[model samples]
Structures are given as C-alpha cells and as structure tokens.
Target: MDATSRHSKILDLLNSQERVEVEDLAARFGVSLQTIRTDLRDLSARGVLSRVHGGAVRVSSAANRAYADRRKQNATAKQTMAALLAEFIPDNCSLAINIGTSTEQAARSLENHRGLTVLSNNINIINLMMGGEAKELILVGGTVRQSDGAIIGEDAV
Candidate 1:
C-alpha cells in the first residue's frame, strides 16, 4: 500500500487495538521494520501515538484507552508487580482494591490467598477472585460501566 494508505491503516489499527508492534505491522504491510518505525515516529510526532521499545500505543488521555487495550498494556509487568504486592499481603486480612488493569492483575495474584476479605468496585475483580481462596468478596453498590466493568456511582465512592 502507499504511504498514505499505510498511515491511515495504522491509525485505524491503533484506534481499535490501542497498540501495534513494528514487526507485526511490517509483516502486515509487506514493508521493512524500519518503514513501520518511521511511520510510528511520524505519528508520534503528530501527537496521535506514542512510540515504545518495539511498538506504538495510542496516545492516552485523561479519559484513558479502551478497557481491553488497557488490560493488554504491560500485562507481564503488572503480573510481576502484583506478585510482589501479594507477598506483602498476609493471610487473614481485609483488603480493598480499586479499579483498573493493574489492580485486576493484583487480584489474580492474590487468588491463592486464604482467610482474606476482598472489597472492590471493579466487577472484573469480583469475578476473578470468586473461585479463589478468598474468604469473602464484597462489591460496592454502583452503576456498572459496561465498557470496562467499573463501578462508578456515588455509592461506590
């Protein structure tokens, strides 16, 4: 495809998926990795995307990226951090968690925990810890945002 078409396609992919790896984009477009990197750099300069090590992510604003995209972002890092956080959390304790992908990862890490009460405003977290060893799970009363499964009502706060 031409450069114009490639740029448009790249933006479309970023909008729907929130991230694109240089290798994948190169393979898809049948171009060199350097071409994709140059395109990403140009897009980044235009304030539409942000370049990372081997990929580019959609420019996140105060509103945040799509929920699915957020979950995929730095997932491995989140899992590692969550494991460390879990180590600090002793058993037989009441713990509260907030909404977001990192918090969800933390919840997964704490699944094997015993004698623990988990209170959260994230619907996903409530579901994730259900089959775990947590003694109790509490979900705050709020309006559930369907897009991200976040509870965001007055009662939640």
Candidate 2:
C-alpha cells in the first residue's frame, strides 16, 4: 500500500490495539524496517502518535485522542448512539451532558427537539445546540481545556 493508506491503517491498528511496534508494522505492511520507522517518525511529528523505543502509541492526554482525529473517528457510530438517546429523551425536557465526541453527537441529534434545556461543560456541545435546537443553553464556568474544548474544574462541578 501507499504511504497515506499505510498511515491510516496504522492509526486503525492503534485504535484497536493501543500500541504498535516497528517490527510488527513492517511485517504487516510488507515494508522494510526503515520505511516503517519513517512512517512512525512522520506520524509522531504530526502529533498524532507518540514514538516509543521500538513502537508508537496513540498520542493521548486524559486518554482522549487529538480533538480533530476524535471528531473523525466513529462518526457514524456516534450518530447512531445519539439517535437512540434522543428517542428516550422526550421533548420539552431538561438535559445535563458532559464533554466528549459522543456528547457532541448527542447534541446534534437533539437539534430537532422542541422546548429543550441543555446544561453542559462541553463547549462543542453548546455550540452545536446553539443553532436554536434548545430553548435554553447553560454552560458551566471553569478553565477551558485547550485540547478538547471542555470546561473543567471545581466551578464546573
């Protein structure tokens, strides 16, 4: 496979396995060790993964992937879950939500509901709900997490 395809496949493996060794990647892709090393180096430089001694692990803080990558990952599945959640949540009801990509999807799914009040610490969810889906949107006050647009602290609690 080509470099782009190889990189995507490597990320997929990391999603399932959490870490990947250079030798294993080289074997799986039928590439040389040097090629696998180069790929790992490039991905690490891009801040997508962290290079270890003989392998790379997902670049994560608080066990959360990079915000952009997380947004792209499992999008359809997230949507499906959000739709199911919305089915159980009646219109004109109040909802409290936390931060994460899945919560963002839930906010999106609830956009069509009427007379909804949403309280959240997730900035992305607030923004998504601001398209007038919710009758009221309350954001918790706290320090904003630059990595994922989440507000956290005692104030948020």
Candidate 1 whole-model C-alpha lDDT, 0 to 1? 0.89
Which of the numbered candidates is closest to the native, going by highest lDDT? Answer: 2
lDDT of 2 by residue, 9-122 (tens): 999999898799999999999999999999999998888899999999988763555788888788999999999998999999999999888889998988899999899999
Model 1: per-residue Cα lDDT over 95-147, one tens digit each? 89998899999999988889999899999998999985647999999899998
Superposition error at 98 for model 1 (Å): 0.6
Count of backbone clashes, every candidate in sequence: 0, 0
Predicted structure 2, TM vs. truth = 0.61
TM of each candidate vs. truth: 0.62, 0.61
